[model samples]
Target: MTTITLVQGDITRQSADAIVNAANSSLLGGGGVDGAIHRRGGPAILEDCRRLRASHYGKGLPTGRAVATTAGNLDARWVIHTVGPRFTREEDRSELLASCYRESLRVADELGARTVAFPAVSAGIYGWPMDDAARIAVETVRATETSVEEVRFVLFDEPAYEAFARQVG
Candidate 1:
């Protein structure tokens, strides 16, 4: 059976089987969680991502798809980076954001990852509502067909933490 866990913490510093990094198309590393992951993961991750980024062009985003990398400083063994859609319109954002969870699970299954950690997609710079994002996350996770044993939502703040906790509970 699969388990969905709501944890108040940092995705960039998780100690699970795999952690999801919300990245841009560049995937080279930008600000926010992306910068933190890159800094901690060191240069090897960037080098691997550069090549992965080239071959995995349009594959970077749209929510559902994910790319894999070695976990540098993180406690996990692998990092599965996913790009979530940012929209002023929910037209595609909803489906895409939900897919982020689904696809991440699929990738984890492929990598034999039994546990996964994620940051709240699009909630920060993407401006997605915290409650809505948490709902989508829990729902999509509930729908996954992979053998992911544990799913952890790592929140960076108290508000986000409480929001997810309320939804999960």
Candidate 2:
């Protein structure tokens, strides 16, 4: 059984075997957690992302899918980039949102990452409600089977942290 933990801090600073980035499809980098990881993780991270863009992800990564790259300057061996779905009331894309966590864990298992730090996928600029995002993330991680010994949700703010805490509790 994996132990779920919550931390109200920057995901970039977490020292885990893998850090999950809530990246956009572009994967080049954007605002929020994606930009933070790219900036702190340094050029090597971007270099790997560029290589991935040139080869496997020419048109950008699809939503709900995930891939890994060098952690660069961050305190981790690998960075798992997962694109989250944009929330909308017209359609239910919760499955895709849940996939972000599931796929990231899948990649972490592949990298032999026993400890992983994750951000709230789509809860930031992507407009997914903080509560729903927290619920989905916690529930998915609880349900998924992986080799990870610890899964830490590194939230960036009090609200995000509280939301995840509610679900975690």
Candidate 3:
């Protein structure tokens, strides 16, 4: 069975096989995880994202939607960016959020990524509670059907790490 690991550190600092960015639909750059990833990866990511966002809109993110730019300043080779839900409206937040995780894993599998890392999507500025967000993340990873051998939750705080650990460990 595939397993998840909880690491207490910065998601932007991780060097997993594929690192996921909780992006806005625009995919250019926004606050929270998207901003952090773009900043660490440098302007190249934002440039590519700007191109993609120009024509990309709506749901499901085109399934195999991903772009491989230079690591900029980060450790990973490819930054697999995916647009997750905003949790702004209280409708179908769970399904939309779960779809983000599932779609990210799908992208990773296509990239032949054996290991992938993710942040707590929708938990930062979207206002989802930490534990609730962690539950969705853990469950989505478990439910996903992919070739990935390792999944890491690169957390920003001790509380988040512990919550993910309890589910995965």
State which candidate has the highest lDDT: 2
Clashing pairs in 2: none
Off by over 4 Å in 2: none
Per-residue lDDT value at 62 in model 1: 45
Off by over 4 Å in 1: 58-62, 90-92
TM-score between candidate 3 and the true structure: 0.86
Higher lDDT: candidate 2 or 3?
2
Better of 1 and 2 by TM-score: 2
TM-score of each: 0.92, 0.99, 0.86
Clashing pairs in 1: none
Q: Write the per-residue lDDT of candidate 1 for residues 19-131, one digit (tens) a residue.
A: 89887767789887788889988887788787885775635544557878999777888888888777566375798889888888989999999999989977888788889
Give one digit per residue, the lDDT tens place, for model 3 in 19-52: 8887766676889888888888898887776666
How well does candidate 1 score on lDDT at residue 67? 77
Whole-model lDDT, candidate 1?
0.83
Candidate 2 per-residue C-alpha lDDT over 88-146 given as tens digits, one digit per residue, 9 for 90 to 100: 99999999999999999999999999999999999999999999999999999999999
